[model samples]
Target: MAKQALGPIRRSFAPWDDPEAKPLIHFRGVTKRYGDFTAVDGIDLPIYEREFHALLGPSGCGKTTLMRMLAGFEEPTEGDVLLDGASLKGVPPYRRPVNMMFQSYALFPHMSVEKNVAFGLKQDGMAKSEIADRVAEMLTLVRLQDFAKRKPHQLSGGQRQRVALARSLAKKPRVLLLDEPLGALDKKLREATQFELTDLQVDLGMTFLIVTHDQEEAMTVADRIAVMDQGVIRQVATPAEIYEQPASRYVADFIGDINILEGRLEKGANGISRLVVPEDGLVVETDQPVESDAQNAWYAIRPEKLRVSLDQPADIAVNTVSGEIWDIAYLGDVSIYHVKLDNGTIMRATTANTTRLVERPISWDDRVWLTWDRNAGVVLTS
Candidate 1:
């Protein structure tokens, strides 16, 4: 099959030099409503040009609704949606300088791949020669040149999806919107396509906006992610930033597996604050100072950060606890140990499975020690 053809490189309008310039796509208090229910509740965001931004959240989190509004399929009840500093209030989907790839791969079964791809251009009344050239280029770009004569039914699922992508890109829109683009593919194919899409985005240098509920997928592909919930954006940052330093307890728990320890703040003599987990009889020292009145707090620690051993390490400074192993799961790469602490609290720790044997250094029901550096745990106030 001929690979998809590359379109002419289009210069981006991103103003990296000017510090005061507005973003490429701006949502100024954008909101959408259906009767009493509000799908998007006054969201304000700025998407820079050439950014692979992902709208990540669970189903019914208003991500799809927000994307539809941006595509001009649904109008916002209030606020403005701006593209390239211009308002999108009166623009229709066909007239807008953007194209959307539907999650269903919405290709017509009766039409050949080439004809399907050329449908949009023909509707715009382009010359036959020009449409043929663009269609040929798009087929090659997507690696479907040989499949141009094949109908949608004769192609594989992945090929059909590529056809949809080619059709969407044939118009060369300013922005490309993908709605769960990889949702239909199998696990192995989805993983392969993720990188392929990322490479395509970088090569094309087009601003791409993807909506998905898969956290791992978003982390893998997006330059930055907007974690949304209940129609509100919880946090917006790079994947690493969002994972390492979440804004709140909800965010901390939602993004990944975290061990949260509830504790009370205690004032120390040196202006440093300590957390007292009375239940665990554990005292964790933190460099961050806390207010005297802030009694309730949580210490968030990733499972991998906790060090597990049969005996406590002498070099440990603070935040150490003794527990008995309750369960052990031997995943090929790592072993997940669930330990019941002396305080009756359960804590999870992951250890590397170095050898290929059934025997474990620490078996279930064995007493073990869990220790971590104070700095490794983040203090969550909210």
Candidate 2:
């Protein structure tokens, strides 16, 4: 099969030279409700120009509601939704300088790919010549030029998704809103599309706001993520910051797998605090000062940061506990070992699978010691 060629890159008329560039999208105490139930509550957020922002959370967390309000499909009950310093209070979805790619990829099965992409331009009353040029450019940009004659039923899932993306981008909107753009594709295709989406956003230099429940997908594609729950924003930060330094137990548990241990903080003479886990009788030192009452505290640790071995290290002086390996799982790239302590508390440790042999240095039911550096764990006050 001959590969489709992307047309010559057109210069974007997007404004980038303004030193005092206002935010592309701004929400001030924005609240949305459906009669008796509140879908989004008092959200205050700002998305900069050309930035890829993701609203990530589980089901019923108000992420979709927030996106709808921004797209002007739903009106806010309380505050304002602003775009490019203009209030979008009464603007309809069609009038707003934004476009949304629905999760269903809403392509007409009877229409060809080129017609599907050209639909939006035709709706805007664009000239025939201009629509043709734009549609051809968008088809080429998505690498779907060769499939322009094919109907939606004849295209693969990924190709249909690209067609939807091309249609959304054809209008040259100031912002693009995506609702679970990759939810329909398989895992491998989803990963590939994420990179392609990131590249497209950069090349077009348009602000992209994505709402997705997939944490890994958000982390992979977003420049920054806003973790939402119960119609409230939990934490907004870069992917690295959100993963490494979670603000609360909910944020810590939601982003990735973590081991949270309840403990009490003990103050020492050196002005440092030590967390004492009552159940495991393990003491963990922390660099954060204990400013509040040390009665109740929690320690969060990632499984990958922990090290497990058959013999305890004599030189180390940190959190160490001996346990018996309860289960083992080989995941190709890494191996997961579930260790049960004497107190019946199970802790997880992940080790790299470097060798191909079934039997290794450690096996299930082996006596092992789990240890981690003091600074590796984070202390959660809440």
Per-model lDDT: 0.87, 0.87
RMSD of 1: 3.9
For candidate 2, write residues 1-382 as lDDT tens digits: 2322322222232232345767788899999889899889999988888788999999999999999998888999999999878899999998988999999999988899999999989999999999999999999999899999999999999999999999999999889999999999999999999988877887776889999999999998888899999999999888887999998899999998888888898877666679888876778887766777568898898888889989978966768888899999888898899999878888888988777876677887999989887778788887
Per-candidate clash tally = 9, 0
In model 1, the worst 10-residue window by lDDT is 1-10
Clash-forming residue pairs, model 2 = none
All models, RMSD in angstroms = 3.9, 4.4
Model 1 bad stretches (over 4 Å) = 1-21, 267-272, 288-293, 354-358
For residue 297, model 2's alpha carbon misses the true position, in angstroms, by 1.6
Winning model by TM-score: 2
